[model samples]
Target: MFKTLADWLAFDVFGLTAESSMGESVHFFIMDITKIFFMLVTIIYIMGLFRSFVSPEKVRTYIQGKSKFAARVLAIVLGAVTPFCSCSSVPLFIGFVEAGIPLGVTFSFLIASPMINEIAVVMLWGMVGWKITALYVASGMVVAFFGGIIMEKFKPERWVEDYVWKIQMGEVQAIEQDNSLPARHRYAFGEVKEIVGRIWKWVIVGVGLGALFHGYFPENWAASLGDANNWLAVPMSVLIGVPLYSNAVGVIPLAEAMLLKGVALGTTLSFMMSIAAISLPELLILRKVIQWQALALFTAIVTVSIMLVGWFFNIIV
Candidate 1:
């Protein structure tokens, strides 16, 4: 349906030849923008309905009472299932700190939350395949799990803002929620509005860039990076991704373009994960809660972990 519309607009309505780069780019842009937005609305609304039952406070409470390993696992699970992006860092971080969640557990949640959401999962499964999606999810969880453990080894509590320790979260308030189906529907619709509003511009930008890549890039433009001997590609991909700030909805289309243009899967995954997990904006937000030392260590550990995941997958797959 979307393809037919794109073709009619680009080739029939616009009277542009399919062979022309302009036509191809137009078709690509229209097709992806429509398809991705449709997916985003449908998936986010469903996830939001499920999310009405859960809250950030509930997440912190669940992790608070568990043993170290159990807490880490629970944190990672909650993080993956939750709809948070890296932009949610400040409030989530503060909540965990105030609740006295362990540094490692909090770190696990922080790492997984932005990197392994349901949108990313569905998008990957649809565009790439279930295998790559599974690998991505598994790698993200592994990185979050061990990354937190390693960060804890640094005794990161010392670097937390003194003010964070001083701010005591008062008694846990059980706010009453309307649990009727209409309320859930309203909540879901609200999420659709808020999330779509936040990411619509990014979706356009990402698809525009992707269209250009798909239409204008040389067929083998990324061939060198795809070669097994090019060890620099994975690290370079991560480095390039660190400064760019975009959610999975924005970056995944670009990633699909890269894949279509012959980029290696590991390098592409590394780029996507880096953008989702460790953007400069997220770091800046985190810096408000933790000192430079802890922030630096967190960055280094996660960066190295992502690089390793990329390198390993590149070798095996």
Candidate 2:
């Protein structure tokens, strides 16, 4: 159905020759843009509704006072489900700290929140394969879990901003009650509009880049540089991805393009993970909450964890 529509739009509507590169690129752009935005709107709305039921205060309460192991686990799970973006990381971090959630556990949530989101999972499942999506989720959870534990062992509480520790949220409270069904639906729609509106441009840009690569880029270029035999490819990809910031949805299409050009799955995934999880923008956001030393440690931990995941996947996959 989708292919037929794309074909009709490209050949009949646009009058592009069916087998031409321009025609293929347009078809891919149209199909991917349609499929991705549909999934983004639908999934983000549902997740937002889920978010409505679970407030930040509740999250703080749930993770506070738990054993380290249990707290880390719960934090990872909560982070995976939360709907916030990297731009909201500092506020969330402050909230967690004020709620008496441990710094390490908060780190777990922070790392997992942007790295392993609903849109990333849904898009990976739709555009990539289920096995790849499953692997991405599992690896992300592991990175969060161990990264939190390592940070806790180092005991970097002093590295947190003194202001963060002083701020308190005792007076603030979660919603007194849930909104009416109509209100809830309206809120969900609002969330969909906000999130989709924010990301639709990036999505289009990503798909455009992907389509360009799919139709015009030289196939052997990435293959030569990022082939499995090149040990430096994984780390190089991670290093390159760290400075660039984009959500998983924005970067996945480019990653898909790389894979089609014969980049190893591990290298491509590592690039996407680094872009989503440890970008320069996130680092700058976190700087407000954590001292330089702690920020360096956090970056080191996540970078090393991502590199290991990349190498492991390259070997096994």
Off by over 4 Å in 1: 85-88
- The sequence of per-residue lDDT tens digits that candidate 1 reaches over residues 1-317 is 98999998889999988898888889888888888888889998998777654468788888877789899999999999887756677778888887778898899888998899888799778767898889989999999999999999999999988888787677789888888888989999999999899989888888898999888987765788776568899999999887787887788888888888888888988888988888677888899989988888988999999999989888988
- Candidate 1: global Cα-lDDT? 0.86
Give the per-residue lDDT of model 2 (tens digit) for 1-317. 66787888988999998578898789878778888888888887877666554456667778888887888898898888777767878878898887777888988888898899888899989888899899999999999988888988888898888898888656655356566777677888999998888888778888998888877777677777567878799899899988877778998888777887778988988888888998777888889988889888998999899999999999897
The lDDT per prediction is 0.86, 0.84
State TM-scores per candidate. 0.95, 0.92
Give the clashing residue pairs of candidate 2, or none. none
Q: How close is candidate 2 to the true structure, as a TM-score?
A: 0.92
Write down the worst ten-residue block by lDDT for model 2: 169-178
